[model samples]
Target: MMSETNPYMMVGERLCMDFINTVSWRESADKRREWFTSYAKWVDWCIHAEVLTGQQAKALLLEAEEKPSEAGDVLKQAIEMREVMYRIFKSISKDISPHQPDLELFNASVSHFYQTLQIIHEKDHYTLKFKQTENNLGIMLPPILQSAVDLLISNNDLERVKQCEGDPCGWLFFDTSRNRSRRWCSMSDCGNRAKARRFYQKEK
Candidate 1:
């Protein structure tokens, strides 16, 4: 189950987009904050994102506790993958091709994802999952990577993809508005701030 109050918001409509937004104030020159500071926090975000079940998260956390070094390495890899993804999608938003290196990095992650694919039966249905072999935390990347690949290849409205207009907020999202006029990440946060700033400027 997910928490009622999370410091992070799921402003991104796509799973991959939400995963990329784990960092706060991503476009800021300074004062940026990382939400996935540790392996446990990363697992928590994964649970909240529904990328991992509660049981899988618990098992992973237990394994991480026993193997801190491995866990740390996985965390680093996850961060690196997230950054590469952000660059690729940010390029897509601008109608520019992703850098060859970024594509290669993403393809590597995709390759790893398929290597560990597994079929499991649960609750009267069968689903594909990454086999949890030895508590390797990098296993988390495949599903997230697949989400990005799906978004890139799908016919879903790519024109609706947008980066928030909020200064220092570089979160990418699919604008699901009928008119495609959505702007800020959230109206209660950046939207309200922008409105207040406009009012203040008008009164000056």
Candidate 2:
């Protein structure tokens, strides 16, 4: 379910899906609504940050609407955006190792993302499988899936990587604010929304 109060969070969650089936041309109106709602937030994040121009965002949205099979290509663009975020993470670190200082955490995060990719590839969306085996201490999840879960737990900031707060959004960005007060993946949308929400709440 998508919540207006936390649009960015919704986008984060949906990114794991290879194709946003809800918003694709083949989906129902309800699914389209859900997809657009989350996608709007994502586009807003990129546009506000200038990572993507208004025209680009609009075109992407149009593409999403017209070509359901192109969802994978759209996701690929998102992955490229994420790479920029990884670079930012590297820049901020003082560690000199060829591998990230937080290599274990990075591996975990990557593994989690990889597992999500596998799920997308295998199932075309999100699906969970649980199996119990005899002679086992207890139930066991697949190792790749476990690694993915562990990665998310290990890398706290993976969630904080944001999109801009602007109308037409661009790429994924990291929030390195001292107070972690960043709103937009780049501040256009996040900041504006924060201000507007505060004003509306105060009026009520």
Candidate 3:
């Protein structure tokens, strides 16, 4: 059963875009920094999904000091982490038999993904220690990822996981519906866009 107050589920489809685009796109230092800044927004969305409280998210962000030079690499790692989570969520949704090899692979993947994050966090100097910033900007992943993983493990329900059906928007989301029939990432965004496009084509 889905929790009534799971913040991670409320992050919406945009979270995936933010995670993937930040790393995949090539831009100047300023643009990279701007994208990194969106991390806070991602955390905020996660908080809304009930994955983490606002206080907890804020503290997590404070744990690592942001270095301008490291922004690109950090973004890359974030995208990788998001992709791993996406795959795990999708596998859980498959409803495969318990003895299936695919299920076993999915379980192993989740474990390895978590361990890899830990190893990377340990090796990165920016993530190893907390530092005070003039503008109070810092970045960290431990608390955020931990909270999300804990929620998924506790629930153990694959039905809550969903991939958006919107065209050109292959984002992952956690469906919290009673009927479990959610399709688009957000009705106001992707859903509306799709509807509008269809209408335009019909008019033509």
Candidate 4:
């Protein structure tokens, strides 16, 4: 059920999966639309994806204005990381190993971001947190990366990761169906179109 007005279609049950699905028509060269056109757009998606609060997004946007070039560089880095993640996860969904270079790139990001990891005691309970500054424009990326890492190491859960069978739609989602019969990115969109196509061909 995708809304016409809303650009955010979060069928991916996992945060990292949704992040990997930021592009529309990913496998279609002509129709593909990149959601993260700028740092501000990335921040906007981060807010929609619940990776950032309104206040944090505002702070980051302000900082980005103050350092436009740095912001652009961070955006480029984020997109590159996203492509690497997409390839790795897509490979996993196909029951294949990710390319060695892609895995190395992913490990590099994991190593870099996890350095900000720290333990915090709140209300007599200990929890791990990324303790980077509030205005860190790339702060939203670490959590998404952690989500991917968690899924990758979950072993059994890796079986649940699937790419939509909707041709060039190319969205990935965590298949939560009990029988694992799910296929398209959405029953209302890709699924319906596929169904109609079958009917049309039969009639023809």
Candidate 5:
């Protein structure tokens, strides 16, 4: 069963956007909630994010059972990387330059994960892949980082990255609309709340 604490909202169209949005009600210190409380929860999120398959998750869980400390370390690393990504993208959405320290940290991770880069030969052609080590439970993180890196360098597409207009929502998304007018993360959730608030103000 999925955890009730996290609704697993996939409102962010891009994988990196969705990964950065794991937290709920981000700006309200009283209501803010973190989704990846433990290694298992992190793995579950990766599964829903399609960053890991069932078989891969199963193996990682088994390994985590044996190396709890290592698993915890991975969780910490994942959250840290996610926060760095959030800050970088949040600045982009607001038309400001991301902090230099954040960019350096992001590049550090990119350099670290790039070590696992390998070329695999397929029937028709070759493909680049991140090799998974049997003992590394954080294997699912590389692709997520790669997604952010791709977007950061996407030039014109970076303009489509936006934060929800909903107050304190703190959710980021990629606007794929032809006219790039998307504001809320989801029309059914934050969007409806905004509409209701506007209506109430009009009546009052």
Candidate 6:
């Protein structure tokens, strides 16, 4: 069930970017509400993001409940990975190199992700997919890792990546616009707020 006050915004064009954006406001010196407060919420976001099916989400939730401590540890790991990705991508957005520690952390996740890779026989072609097993937490990570890997390896894709111009809303996104002029996380949210602020300043 979705929370009445849930703030899981998905403004990023890419899955990994959206996941990094689970943190509400990035440029804010003070912290904001973290969307993935628990393993269940993370599962919910995965379901909302279409990363997991209803049945898969239900099973993961059941497993989490059975092993609460393990679930917490996984959640902590997820958040740590998320922050590392955020820093690395933010550096990329600025055309700067990511910190060594962040790059090492990302490589560790990538190494783990590659270990689960498998080929699936689809209707016409063999598609690559992660091997789903009893280690649900580990299984959940590869798709997100793949998204990051895909963006990092593509020069054009990396060039289109941007950080939102809205103050304190330092979310990253893939600028899918033809002109690559996307400057805000969302026109309805930060964009409008910025415009309103400009209007108020002009009047003053």
Question: Tell me, what's the RMSD of every candidate?
Answer: 2.4, 16.4, 10.6, 1.7, 2.5, 2.6
In candidate 3, stretches whose alpha carbon ends up further than 4 angstroms from where it belongs are 1-10, 13-34, 37-76, 91-139, 154-156
| lDDT of each residue in 59-121, candidate 2, tens digit only | 666755666445444444443433433343333322233245445544554454444333322
TM-score winner, 1 or 4 = 4
Residue 185 in model 2: lDDT: 38
For candidate 3, write residues 90-182 as lDDT tens digits.
555565433345345545644644544432245545352223233232233444455445546656555666656665555556666778888
Residue 65 accuracy (lDDT) in model 2: 62
* Residue-wise C-alpha lDDT for candidate 6, range 145-196, written one tens digit per residue: 8999999999777978889998889899989999988999899888999999
Arrange candidates by TM-score, descending. Answer: 4, 5, 6, 1, 3, 2
The alpha-carbon lDDT assigned to residue 179 of candidate 1 equals 96
Cα-based lDDT for every prediction = 0.86, 0.41, 0.50, 0.91, 0.92, 0.86
Candidate 1 residues 1-204, lDDT tens each?
A: 123765569989888999998888999979689998999999998887888889989988988988899999999999999999999988888888889999999998888677888889999999988776564666677788888888888746777778888898998988888999999878887888899999999999
Better of 2 and 4 by lDDT: 4
What lDDT tens digits, residue by residue, belong to model 5 across residues 46-157?
Answer: 8888898889899899999999999999999999999999999999999999999999999999999988899999999999999876547999889999999899899889
- lDDT accuracy of residue 76 in candidate 1: 94
Residue 38's lDDT in candidate 1:
97
Total backbone clashes of model 1?
A: 0
Per-candidate TM equals 0.90, 0.27, 0.48, 0.95, 0.95, 0.92
Which should have the higher lDDT, number 2 or number 3? 3
Backbone clashes under 3 angstroms, per model: 0, 21, 9, 0, 0, 0
- Candidate 4 lDDT by residue in tens digits, 1-204: 456645688899999999999999999999999999999999998988889989999999999999999899889989999999999999989999999999999999999999889999999899999988653878988999999999999999999999998888989999999999889888987899899999999999
Quote model 6's TM-score. Answer: 0.92
lDDT of 3: 0.50
